[model samples]
Target: MRVTLYLRCRGIAPGTVDLVSTGLKTDHRGILVFTLPDNHPETLRLGTNDLTALNPEGRVPILLLPDGRKMTQSGPIIDLIESTLAPDDDITLLPTDPWIRAEVQRIMWIIAADTQPYQNIPFIIQAMGEWGMVKDNPTRHPLRLHFIRREFGAIENLLTRCAGKFAVGDSVTLADCFLVPQIRNALLAEIDLPSEFPILSTVWNNLLDVPAIRAVLDDAGGIVQPLVYDAEQFEVYNG
Candidate 1:
């Protein structure tokens, strides 16, 4: 049976398509980008294309068969990614190289959690929405830039600590893909790409050269926020 994956290319629901795309990249993911980049010019494919009725939170799972019957098994994405791991990839209580893996995990935690918690971002946005209001007289408050800049600064420090071409280990892992998007988002929030955080600038400039990211972009669909971000606003936001 073919696997169907739901992906959002943008925001905190922040689907770092890299992890998911690993399937497609390695012919592991049976799914395809719904819209080709040329046709759909949005960076993050942020929409409700895939909504399964038997969600994990529901306790009862629903599994949809090719024949069209629904049996409950709502953990499809995890199943899909797990299926893609190589022969060496195994689930263990501890890795053979515990120290190395621990460091890697630490970096991953910061990047995944502290760097940009895409998962909990909605709550932040929801809170911001409640805390502030938008009206015709003033669409947004200038202070928002400062709030975002602080966030970007945190990421910059993380990136700077790992300031090599990519994030985390010498090889690309879960961290690089995320750091890349967070930097891109910082730009979208009008955070300066360079001056505000030179370390981030150095790391980011280096990330631009990574082949995996470039390859991912080639396959990525829609208009990316990074591709259209404004420089001054980016500076003000990151600055």
Candidate 2:
């Protein structure tokens, strides 16, 4: 069966999440990946474009399934992929042990729920301009760092207990798919992973060597460049 994955640049969290998740599985060889260039005409038209019909949120990483169904949101999309795999599949993103599975989800949620949303570019713009939050004019605002640091601190502590090589164990799991991208975001935000969160830093460093993670990073263009939001341009699409 063929699957179509709609993604944006690696800088975007959801895209990176799906990219890493799909790359990890050997059964996904038939998947076709399409990446929208940053600020492309099609991308600028997201909210009103044909794409909006597929996902009203106007987000990337929409997985078009073979049966003419589409799925969105990184967590659910990853879960769907995991669900389809054979129980004895040599490559699994989730562990079979119930308690270990819970640990994986715990770390994944720390990044997915507590961290990424608060640091999203549009949210940062609205927080500062519309909500009257204090503005620190960095590529990623201080407000973004506030959430990143807070959640990453929690992840770091948890890693000290559950982590072996990856986020949960020596094998790569769903948590690592959520993790490596957030660490990329934190690094882009100028967080010193090694100094502030050493365990997470080690996990991030170790993941870099994994073939699947490396493939996603290579496809995503090595290190992520800081996102630059043009207010006038944003208005054209979001208005």
Candidate 3:
């Protein structure tokens, strides 16, 4: 069954990249479907806070299956993809080895829960706005950079122990899927790539060699590949 992915053009929702990349590596059937970026005037008119059962949280990174079921949120969607879509073979994005699997989950938690939430564009926008700041405010951008830097620093230390060619091993795993898009976001925020964290840079560069990962990056027009992004269309909402 072919799946349809609803993802934003920016790397703001790194989980979408993780889900799509995992599906690709496991040979799970799927297709790309871009969502209207959150900043669109029409999206604003729809009311940012109004989320439905089909789109709980009013978020992207939704996966629609051929059977008409919609999958929302990054973590649950990733879990679904791994358990249901991945073949019971060597190429699975989730590590089969028990210890390695645990390590992968550890890295994933750091990225998904610790790192992503702080800098999530919508969440930051909402939270900052509540405090009397608005989108494009000078203070909001610095606040995002602060959390991103701290999270990346923690990941850098963790990578020193678990990383090989990738975050958990020589192969691309869920951890890499989570980390790559975060790194891309960091790049757009002017977080000096490769220079700040050499190990992560190596892993990010290596992972892009995978066709599935590359294709998603191209489709999303993430920071790493500026050529794929439309100049006028993609505005960095978070920064």
Candidate 4:
């Protein structure tokens, strides 16, 4: 059964891109596309303010299996992909060793749960609107930056132990999957990753050549450029 994955293109949904690209790399049958027309409820299944109330599992990157089963949330989707792999498959985004997998999850979570949400543009814009603040208000961006950088700091320390060619000991793992997109976000936000986190910059540069990573990114029009918003000319995506 060919799977269908609905993803967001405009803002930073790196986790979705990561898992889908991983699925593609592992030779999973799937069609990956964007949620166009912005916030149309069908695609954006999670309600604007009450996602937990709607579906705590999450709302984007909805995957439809050929058997008519629906899947949501990046984590479980990734788990499904890994579980379906054949015994001989050479691609494994996770390590076999127990300790290493745990380490990989540690780094991945720092980005997935800790850092990425603050920069979700649609949520931020919606919050700004609800607060009756101008969308372009300078006060908004810094707040997200603060949290993102703090998480990045923690990731930096974690990577120091296991990072090699990728986020964990010379192989691309789930950690790498989560890492690249957040770095892409950092770049979009003009965070100066090269200056702030040279080790991460090296890992990211190395990731570009990986076939699956490159394919998904190329499909998305290369490295994500920030979608500009609010008349201030700050780069961002249309939400």
- Could you arrange the candidates by TM-score from highest to lowest? 2, 4, 3, 1
> For residues 157-224, could you state the per-residue lDDT of candidate 4 as single tens digits?
77788889887888767787777767767777778877898788788888877766766666655676
Please report the candidate that would top TM-score against the real structure: 2
Two-way lDDT contest, 2 vs 3, winner: 2
* Model 4 segments more than 4 A misplaced: 1-58, 132-140, 226-239
Off by over 4 Å in 3: 1-53, 65-69, 133-140, 225-239
Maximum-lDDT candidate: 2
TM-score of 3: 0.67
Worst 10 residues of 2 by lDDT: 1-10
TM-scores vs. true structure, each candidate: 0.48, 0.75, 0.67, 0.69
RMSD of 4: 9.8
Write down the lDDT that model 4 would get: 0.59
What would the per-residue lDDT of candidate 3 be over residues 51-168, giving only the tens digit for each residue?
A: 3433755446666665667787676776775555335465666677898899988887887788777875544555544565545532237777888888888888888999998887
Residues 84-175 of candidate 1: C-alpha lDDT, one tens digit per residue? 44434332211347665565456545544554443233223333334553311111223445444665676567655654554543454444
lDDT winner between candidates 1 and 4: 4
